[model samples]
Target: MSRTDPQFKLRVPAALRLQIEQAAQATRRSMNAEMVVRLEASFAKEQPLQEKAHDQ
Candidate 1:
């Protein structure tokens, strides 16, 4: 995200933090970017299920 984007403090467990750090390094992304990408993927995956449930 750009410097102008809104920012917030997040607190995660140390183990989870380490996992994110490793994943970020493997993917060549900042930790924040890795989190954002994973979060968005989760939402995208859930949306299809949500839409199917709404249709039923």
Candidate 2:
């Protein structure tokens, strides 16, 4: 997606937000991009586990 595109908003705890911001700065990416990448990876990892549990 384009950087200018409308993005979804996620509300996180203050401490978590600070951690995300710090990581974003370290990675040289904006908070939005960093969060999206993290969340996408998490979901990708989780989906297979969820599917396996459902099949059991």
Candidate 3:
């Protein structure tokens, strides 16, 4: 939620939203922060697959 970063509005299913809220509460992070961390982790996980694909 920085002024410099592009902002987006997301619409998620109710179940997913509840999961995120619960995770945020457990981790003491805002819902937005929780989502961002999860997104970054997912993208980071993809990089290894992408590197292997390029090596093939």
The best candidate in terms of TM-score? 1
Enumerate residue pairs that collide in model 3.
Answer: none
Error of 3 at 15 (Å): 0.9
Residue 30 lDDT in model 2?
A: 93
Please list the Cα RMSD from the true structure of every candidate, rounded to 1 decimal place.
1.2, 2.2, 1.4
**What TM-score would every model get versus the actual structure?**
0.86, 0.70, 0.84
Quote the lDDT for 40 in model 1: 97
Count clashes in each candidate, considering only residues at least 3 apart in sequence or on different chains. 0, 0, 0
| lDDT of each residue in 1-56, candidate 3, tens digit only | 67689887999999999999999999999998999999999999999999999999
lDDT of 1 at 47: 100
Model 2 lDDT per residue over 1-56, tens place: 48788876777899999999999999999988898899899999999999999999
Q: For residue 27, give model 2's deviation from the true position in Å.
A: 0.8
Q: Residue 45, candidate 1: how far off, in angstroms?
A: 0.2
Q: Which stretches of candidate 3 lie over 4 Å from their true place?
A: none
Alpha carbon deviation, residue 21, candidate 3 (Å): 0.5
Q: Is candidate 1 or 3 superior in lDDT?
A: 1
User: How would you order the candidates by TM-score, starting with the best?
Assistant: 1, 3, 2
Each prediction's whole-model lDDT (CA): 0.98, 0.91, 0.95
Report the candidate with higher lDDT, 1 versus 2.
1
